[model samples]
Structure formats: structure tokens, C-alpha cells
Target: MYPPKSFDIGWPDLAYGLAACGRDGDADRWAATVERRFGDGGTKGPESAAGSGANGWEPAAGGGANGCLAALSVRSALDLALAAAALPRGSEVLMSAVTIPDMWRIVVGHGLVPVPVDVDAGTLLPAAAQWAAAATPRTRAVVVAHLFGTRAPLDSLAELAARRGWLLVEDCAQAYDGPDFRGSPGADVSLFSFGPIKTATALGGAVAVVRNPGLLATMRALHQEWPVQGPGDQARRIAKYTALALLTARPVYTGAVTAAGLLGRDHEGGLQERVGAFAGTDLMPAIRHRPGPALLALLDRRLRAADTVRAVARRAAVARRLVVRLPDPSMVYGADAPVHTFWLCAVPTPDPAATIARLRSAGFDAARPTSLGAVPAPPDHQQGARTAAHLVRHAVCLPLRPGMPDRVLDRMAAVLDPEDWGPAPGP
Candidate 1:
């Protein structure tokens, strides 16, 4: 059995991420901003960092010059964008059926209807044909989600949106480190997340980049109406992030995760139950709160230190090795793209549950990626959408992170070889 430590994070990366939580010499300035915005005697200390300049918060210095607005979370950023677009109530916004359910809630919360389209089984991207088939008189926008760090067909989707006079939104929460196409010709707006599990961890934060000046102004105005995160909430977030940084550290994380796996309590659903979010059951507040200065500072530091080219090359090398060993058609995606980033090396299998169990018993962490629930099918692509859903149900994502050990990769490859294991049982 491969050690549980193989699934944990690297020591250097964890230390670097935690270093951002240190004092950045902006505490006094942040406190003054909080007092000026929320008045004196309020949640005043580090706890009120996210609440500083509630109504007056502008995008972090360099971010605004390019029309990118920062928010507390991606869900809030999307909500702000939808409101800024000012689409008619009940207008339809199409999305891939194989996405996180939180996106559905955001669209519905904005009083807009979410139309689901099927994704390409291999790429996990909705094709232009799927989008065209989903279009209708009421369709007002299309959100192109770039899943698992792969780019979507932005040029084609942009042309379709332009011809149909519909808004084009790019969901780059998982693909932030993959490519920098925010202001590209085809996309009207893009949304990103800086959560703990993302490519770079900022604890909790999100950003929205708007290409249209009118939309940016509208979003900024809407941003002021939402209540700022209170000092208590800020404190909780800081504590949570801090705890995560510590928990994911090498020695501690390995022991904790290994024990949890042994106890049968380390599955994705169980983890979600503990986190109380991301499963679409516990909805987050729909307010457009800004990320605290500390979090932003951390994000900025991480961005500066990131080497996208090297990261992608490293991931590609590992992926290629796995492909050579496993030789499964469903083991990889978008290998032919101009650029590829392996956020999660997902493989489609006939029995996802069994495969996950086998991997877990072998001391490797593996599980199915997030999927939408109860999504309504597009009027014209029901069969295609169903096919996509089926594929998603059977796909299992392998554990792959930068700087992981070669032994771990070899173990994974060995486990995937069919000769080592006979026929998989039915779900």
C-alpha cells in the first residue's frame, strides 16, 4: 500500500502558503480603513479585515487598472456579474451540466433560469454545437466553465454569443494557473477562486475580470450594496484558513489523513460534510464581500512567486508517464492542446466506486470529481447531456500535485494495470 502521505501536500509549498498569513505591515492602515468605513467601536481588529471600506472598497491597486474586481468568493463574484449584466428576470443562462451545483444556485438566486448543456466526454467542455442546441429566445448568456485546468473553445463560443447577442462568462475557478485569457477577444467576463484547494491558496477569495466598462461600473455599484463580512466572520475565516494550513502540513496531514482513511471517514462526501459547504446543500451567503487585505496580500505574493510554465511542464511530464504505464483511453484529457495543466488527472472507468475503493485500500486517495445535481436538460441536446452525465458519474480523479514523489506515481500506474486486477464489479 502506498503511504497516505503521498496524498498530502509538500512541505515547502505548505510553508510558503502559510508565510502569507504573517504580518505584512498593513495592519494599522487596514484598521483605519475599517474605522472609516464601518465607524468606530465596531469589529475593529484583524477580525474586521474583510469588512474594511465596505462600500468604498475598490479592486486591489493593480487589479482595477485592468477592470478586474475582487470579491470574497467566486459565487459572490458571479452574482455581482449577473446583476450587473441586468438581464431580464427569468432570462436563461446556459452552463455545462457537469459543474458544481453552487453555480446553479447563483444563477437561480439572480432570478435567472439556468439551462444545462452536455459536455464533450473527453474534454469536459461544452461544444459550440451543444451551446447552439441549447439556445432559445429566452437565452441571454452562456457560461463557459474550463474544467480541470483545461481551456474551453473560447473563440467558437465567443462567436456564437456574439451572433446570438448573449453574454459570455468564463468560469476559471479551477483554471486560474492554466492560462491567462481573461481579457481575450472571445470572453466578456471571467471568474476565479483562491480557495484552499485551488492551484494557489489564498485561504478564501475570488476575482472577477470584466471586459466591458459599462458592466464593470454596474458591478462596482452593485458591490457596494452588499453587507461586508463582519469582524467575527473574518476571524472565523482566518482561523479556518490557518487551521487548514497547519492540517495540510506534511507530518501532521499524513497521520491525520491515514487515520481517517483507516476509519472509513476520509471520502469526499465525508470531507464535505465536515466542511459544511461545496456540496450545494449548505449555501453560502449571497453577499459580495471583499477579500480581506491579508488574504489579498497573500494572493498577490503567491501570484508573484508562481511559475506557470514550469508548473505546467512538471504536471505534463507526470501525466505522460502515467499514460505510458496505464495506456487507458480515458486516463487523460486535452493532451493535444497548445498548453495543458493537470489539476486533477481524472480517469473514466466503468466502476468509479469500486476503483476508488481499491485505490483507497491500496493507500492511495482517489475519488470522483464534483457533479451537478437534478440539472434540467437542454431542449435540443437531451441525449448528449445524458451522455455527459453518465461519463461524469464514472470518472475518478487521481491524486496528482506538483513535486509529488515518483514512487507514488509508479504505485498509481501499477494499480491501474488491468493485469494486476481482474474484472471490476458492478456499482
Candidate 2:
């Protein structure tokens, strides 16, 4: 039972973890730097300043060439963006009805109302008309998340936001290294995640780019006041990352998967739960923690070796092969996007659990990305939102990683036959 996908940690991550155990000297130096810059509580620290093109930290194309802010995660970045935007309390923020649960929490936590907009069944993105229909007088902002590495229709959404005098925030958490990767030139702010499953896994971190200098200043101020992750927290992260790396190593992963199967467990799901169960006191939301030097070094190494262009090309090639072999190519989400990095080669079906079971039986790992049944929807958009929600429940994400073996793709395609997974046609 090979899991659908595993963490991208490798030798470098292991080395970093080993070094982190005795990195007291490096940690002390970082603490001194933090104290020197932020001790007074009035000046910004090196970590906060790193996003401002200082200390060799420059914004990437996906993040835009603007002042940037680093955060503990994408949720934190969104929190900072919402605060910096200074929308009136309880202002409406339009977002796709089908999105991560954490995103909804962050929006509501910021004293903002999340207005859910229905998404297109094919592309899994909200249409500009949908956005307009969802907008109310209280709508102050729109968050366009590029789901599954599909480039959202940013140009149209941007125009709509402009006409309504609404701020546009691009959620590029899944669309980095994509075509038009800057994520809507018209966006007031853009956010990118480097979490475990993202294109560039930094164990955990995120970047937010602000187009306006004033907003950047405001976010920087907020960052300076936010608490940093303590040494214990950092140590826990290192241990978790290392454990995942070892568990997912080729030699160990098969046995781990078998053990999970013996216990009647879902390999991927169980692994995610285990990895996320941290023991230390939880940091406050939106706290800006400086990644340790070792972690930063590992991230830099991963980025340099990523070769995103080649990786995207490989993903596109695999997607093309999958489309030709699958029973219904049109059911593949993001197939028609302007550019697709195929972060998740998702296909909408009528019964995802059954399909995944079939694929697993056929010796191919497959799973659903997330559950949308719990997401809230507005009355007016209920019909369309329900459609998207159903699509999410039945959407199967096939394994599509850079340099994946062709045999795995073939097995996945074979199991996708209508006879095995159910009828391909859907309303």
C-alpha cells in the first residue's frame, strides 16, 4: 500500500535535523540578532526585515516584486494581510465555497465575514459572474485561491473587484511556478505557502507580498509585535520533519504502509494526523517566527534544486498521458487552464471512495484531497455551492509528482475505466 504521496523530505532534511540537535550556537546567534533588532519592541527584527529585500530575501515571481512578509504558515500570512488591509470589522470577504477549513477559520477569526461563492465544476474556480453575484454592499475583499495548481481566471476577477472597489488577494499557495505565476498583476496582495505538500516544502513557512508600501509598513509593524516561535517549538518541528523523512524513506515506507493496513488504517490520512499532533504550547495565530538557520539553509537548497520549469514540464507530460488513458478527460480538473502545474491531478467522479478503493486494488495509490461537506454556504448560492460541494466529495486526486514512474501512471489509468469506477458522464 504505497501512499498516494509522501513528504518530499530527503537526505538534506535528515542532515539538517541531525545538525539541529546541537545547534545551540546557531540558535544563540539568531536570538542575539532578534534581540538587537526587536528588543526595544519598536524596531523591526531581521526576520521581519528579511521580506523587504534585505538579508538576501527577495520576493519570487509568484510572490510579485513587492515588499514581502514571511510567516509561520499561509494562514498566518492571510491573517496579516487581512489586518493590514484594515477592512471594517465584519466586512464581507468573498471566497470560493470549496476551500481549506483553516482558511475559513482565519477569515472568521479576523472579524471578517466569509462570503462563499460557487465554483465552476470543471475548473474548480469561481467564475467572475459568480463573484459578482456573491458580492454584497459589505463585501470589501475577494480571495482568489488557485486550487490544485490551476491558474484561476485572475484577469476577469481583477476587473470585477476593481469595478466593485474591492480588494483582491491572490492565494497562490498551490499555484507557484505556474504560468502567470505572479498571480494576478492586479492583486493588492499575494500569498504563497511552502508547507509540507506545497511545490517547495520548507517543512513550514509562507510568504506574503504587499503591492502597497503603506500596507507593507503596517504588516511589518504587526509582525514586529507578534511572538516568535520558541526554541522548544522549533525543536519539535525539526523532530517531526525528521520522523516523516525517515518514515517515508523508500526502504521504510512500504513496511509502514503494510503496518497501517494491518491496523485497518488509511496510510495517508493517519500519517497526516500523526505529523500534525504537536506537543508544545501552540503559538498565537499570525505570530511571525524566524525559521532557524538550518531550516533556511535546507529551504534554499531545495529551491535551488527544484528546477520548477522542468518539473512543470514533466507534470504536464504526465497529465497529458493521464488524459488520453482515462475514461473521461474532461472530468480532469485544470486540464483546460491556461497553464497547469498538476500539483494534484484531480478528476471529478460520482463516487470518489469507490474509485479510490478500485485504484488501490489495482495497485495504484489514489485519494480525495479534502472533505467539503462541512463547508458553509449562503442561501442564494446554495444550488451552485452544493454542486461544487458534491464535486469535491467525489473528486479523486491521482498521484502526479515530478519524475513519477510510468508504470504507476499506467495502473492509475487502467483503474479509471468507467466499468471499474462508475459511469463517466455527470450532470
Candidate 3:
């Protein structure tokens, strides 16, 4: 069966990471190199970069000296940004309705309310007007996540935030295409991830561009106080992913699935647990830390060495083929973005459990996205996020990978044809 996801890391990078784990490299030096290389921490393109040329792309500097900060993960970065912002207790953070549950959890953890703005599954973007309607006097910030590898239109959201004096953050965790296509120009901060499942995976890390120098400094100071991750932790991660990476092979995965069934094990559950960044650990403590030296070194290397744009282009090409074959194109989520890399292409099915069974029968191991959810709309704005909630309920992602054979694409499309996977007929 086809695996549901592929780690972006290669063996060479893994080997390099393993070697770096043994070195006593200066964490500060590697972190500084990453921060400097990523630009002055503004979307202002590479000009903010201490040096440029190879992969320089940031949007706008936001009228100040921008700075970049490195963290253990995007989850860690947001925690720092929110803590530094130090918004008043009970303030509301306007957010795109659909996102990983942890993001809203982070907001709540900081004593703030998350007001979810509805999104169009096609664009994976919340309408700006909906954002306006959702924002109350208590709203102090907006966190817009670019979901499913699609870059949402940021101009209007940025304008709204600027008009209301609200902090605007772009969660580009799933939208990192490469050195180019930096976060939106109008955003106060833009976050990028390099986790186990994200593009250009460094196994685990995050980089953020902070438009406000003061906030950056505050986050930096706060980040420094957190304990550093141990080298052994990263070493285990490298080893784990290396083993998981091997299961992408069809024969091994097939045999493993059979073995799992025979042993009465929930194989998918086991996979999710293994892939989790902090599986079985308490949330806050696990994330509140400086990167270990090994992570820093590997993150810097992956940023420089990752040939991301081409990889994204290849995926898009395959996704386009799939979309063309769908019985109803609208069944596919995130098809309306200006640029969709199809990082995790999924379809909204009326019966997702049945759909997964069907895909599995056809040699595809489809699964629901356990990591994503609709940030429930607040009490006053309950109707605003229906679409986001609907999509989350019905979405089941197929296993679409780079370099997949043409036969696989054709067969996958056939499974989605009108006779097979489309919505039910009228009564």
C-alpha cells in the first residue's frame, strides 16, 4: 500500500545530521547563521539578509530592521511570539478556522481566546470580511495559517490587521516552497517549519521573520531562558525517521500491513504516534526550549542545500493531473489557491471511513488528517466557520508522493471518478 506521507529528508541529509550530532558545534553560531541567512526577519526579501544571492526571498521589511529567530518548531515559535506580545488576559486572536489544534491550544494556553474566521476550502483562506465580522473589541491579533501547501492571499488580511492595529502572523508551516516566495509583505511575522512531514524537513525546526525589532528581542530573550534540547533527543529523532523512511517502500509496507493485521495492531495509530514531534510528552515543556546544537547545524544545512522549488513544481504537476480527473473538482480542497504545491492533497468525502477502505483496496493507504481541525467559531461568531468545520469533518488525504508512477495516478483518479467517490445522489 502507498504510504500516506513522505518525509522530505534524504539519506545524505540524514547522514549529515547524524554526523553533526556527534560534533560539538557552537549552537549559537549555527543559529546565527540560520537567522542571518533567512534575512533580516522581515518579508522584505533578501535585502534584510546579511548576505544574499543563492536562495534569498523575503517580502517587506515592514519599515524597520527586521530579524529572524530560530526555534524548535513552529509551535514553539508561536508560543514565544504570543508570550512576547504579552497581550492582555482574555484578549482574542482572530485565526483562520481550520488549523492544527495545537495552534489554538497555544492561544488558549496563553490566556487568550481564539476567534476562528471561516475559510473557503477551495482557497484554504478565510474571507477578509469574515475576519472583520469576527473581530471584536477584545481582538488583538490574527494568525493566518497557509494550509495544505497553499499560499493564501495575504494583502487583504494584512490591510485589515493594519487598520485595526492588530498583530498579523502568517503561519507558513505547510507553505514553504523554497528560498523564494517568502511570507506575505504585510504580515508582522511569518513562520516556516522544517518538521518531519513538512517540505525541506530538517527532521525538526522552525524559522520566523519578525517585523518588529522589539518583539524579536523579547522573543529571543524569552527563548534563551528555556532549557536546551539534549543531543540524544535529536539523535533518536534522526534514527526514528530513518527507520520510518524505509517503510515507504511498497513491499515492506505491504508486508508490514499484513503483519500488523495478524498481530491485531492498529498500524496507522502506531505510525502517527511515532511521527509525532512530541508524542506522549506534555505539550508546553517539550516545546519550550532552545534548539540543540545538532538541530541547529542540520537546520542551517537543509536551508542552504534544499532544492525545494523544483520538488514543489514536480508535486504540483502530479496534483494537476489528479484534479483534472476528479468527478467534481470542488471535491478537492485547496484547489483555488494562487499556488498550491499539493503537499497533502485530500478530498472531502461524505463517508471518509468508507473512502479510506476503498482506497486501501486499490493499493492506497488513505487516512484522515489527525493533525488538523477547525478552530471552533467563538460564541458570537458561531456561523462564520461552517465551511472550515465541514471540510475538516469530510477530508481524507490520499497518499500522493513525488516520482510516483503514471499508473498509480490513473488508478487513484479512477477511484475518485463519479461512479466511485462523488457525493451521493438526490433522494
Instruction: Estimate the TM-score for candidate 3.
Output: 0.91
What is candidate 2's TM-score against the reference? 0.82
Candidate 3's residue-wise lDDT over 233-295, tens digit each?
A: 899999999999998667888889889989999888899889878778888988998898788
The digit string of per-residue lDDT tens for model 2 on 1-427 reads 4556566556655565446535543422332232222121212232344432343233211222235665667777777788888899878889877777777767787888787776665666776677887777889998777778788558888888888888888888888762225456788888877677676566766666667788877876776676555546556666777777777665587788677789998787876566542213243332445555444434443444435556667766877777777877766776667767677787876777788878777656677775233247544434446645665677788866656577777777877767544322233
Question: How many angstroms is residue 61 displaced in model 1 relative to the true structure, after the best TM-score fit?
Answer: 6.5
Better of 1 and 3 by TM-score: 3
lDDT of 1 by residue, 1-427 (tens): 3222121223454444344345343422432332222112112222333332332232122111346676777787788888888899989898877677788878888888888877665566766677887787999998777777776557888888988899888888767653344434678888877665666555566667777889988987877676654434444555655565565555666677777768977545654443432433345563456555555544443443336446657765776666666746444644434445666666667677788777866666676665434356545434446645665667677766556577777777777757433221211
Candidate 3: stretches off by over 4 Å: 40-66, 379-381, 417-427
| Evaluation by lDDT, superior candidate among 1 and 3 | 3
TM-scores for every predicted model = 0.78, 0.82, 0.91
The positional error of residue 200 in candidate 2, measured at the CA in angstroms, is: 1.7
lDDT of 3 at 143: 94
Clashes in each model (backbone N, CA, C under 3 Å)? 0, 0, 10
lDDT of each: 0.60, 0.64, 0.81
